[model samples]
Target: MKKQFAIIGMGRFGSSICRELFHMGHEVIAIDTDEKKLSLARSFTTETFVGNGTDESFLEKIGIRNFDHVIVAIGDDIQASILTTLHVKDQNVPNVWVKAQNDYHHKVLDKIGADRIFHPEKEMGSRIAAYLTSDTVLDYIDLSADYSIIEMLATKKVAGKTLIELDPRKRYGCTVIAVKQKHQVDVTPDPAEPIKEGDILILIGDKRDLRRFREGELS
Candidate 1:
């Protein structure tokens, strides 16, 4: 289903969201104080506005309440970012997501009822650090402080073994949610399905359990 999205900044992050959503056949309205930045978004979205996003009147004029999702991706000026998120939330946009600059920014966005808050830099940094530091972990997703999802390459130790034989859930308290080999992906793969040497196993579990499981794989 197509969704309508309003992005309140034309910076790298906001522009990326606008471009992707528009390319995916969603209605994307891009706004920025910089006319030049807004102009860059024109090819991706038909609706481009130059205005102060912090102003409730400007938001109202743009029909922000009509949007299914609104993203406040202001990179700098934490005050403007907070105020714009406040105005968007006040307008009662159903899904309001914000790019938080810091922990302080994240807390403020949460206080103002942002549906989701993301630290894109921190997230990417963590994922990259994981990949760089671990041979088995190809990707990592932080679900919470304790829980995570990890994509691990099936090494020689586990190659050609079935999931039931591995019994990750019983032995390590992790669940293999999916397996991908080349272009093909299997979700909730059968216990009898054999894992290939290069297959990527997607597992979800507590972070501690994941570390232990990975350590065992290394040993």
Candidate 2:
């Protein structure tokens, strides 16, 4: 289903999101105080506005409250970001997401009822660290401090073996929740199903257990 999104900034982060959401067929309204920034967003967004997002009157006039999601990506202007977020929330926007500049900024946003907060630099660093840590890991998502879900490419070490033979739950302390072979995805695959080389396995496990499995099995 399509969603209506209002992005109240046009910096690199906001512009990238606007383009992606537009390409995904969602309705996006891009707003910024700078005409140059608005120009960049005009091609990708359904609407582009040159105005201060912190101005509640301007926001209401643009129908910000009607948006399904509102993103506050004001760059480095903490006060503006905060006021914009507050106004958006006050208007009762269903989902308000913000890009926080620091820990203090995040705390303020949290207290002000921002549904989601993002630290792009920190998140990208963590993702890069995960990629550098393992060669077989195609993707990683931290479920908690101790648990994670990882997508690992099945290699010769694991090929031609059934889940029963591998017994990952008992041996590696990890669970193979799904497997992707070519374009097909098998969720909760049968224990007797053969795992082929080049297949991708979606596994969930404690961090330590995942590291052990990666070293003893994937390596």
* Candidate 2 lDDT score at position 67: 82
Give the clash count for each candidate: 0, 0
Candidate 1, superposed: residue stretches over 4 Å from native: 123-188, 191-219
TM-score of model 2 (CA atoms): 0.61
Which 10 consecutive residues of model 1 have the lowest summed lDDT? 124-133
Residue 64 C-alpha lDDT in model 2: 89
Q: What does candidate 2's lDDT look like per residue over 1-219, in tens digits?
A: 456788889998788777767765678889999999898778999989889988999999988888878888899999999999999999999889898999999999999999978887755423433443456889888888779898888889988899899888999899999999899999969889888899898999996687677777777
**TM-scores vs. true structure, each candidate:** 0.60, 0.61
Q: After superposition, how far is residue 109 of candidate 2 from its true place, in Å?
A: 0.5
Quote the positional error of residue 35 for candidate 1 in Å.
0.3
Q: After best superposition, candidate 1 residue 32: deviation in angstroms?
A: 0.5
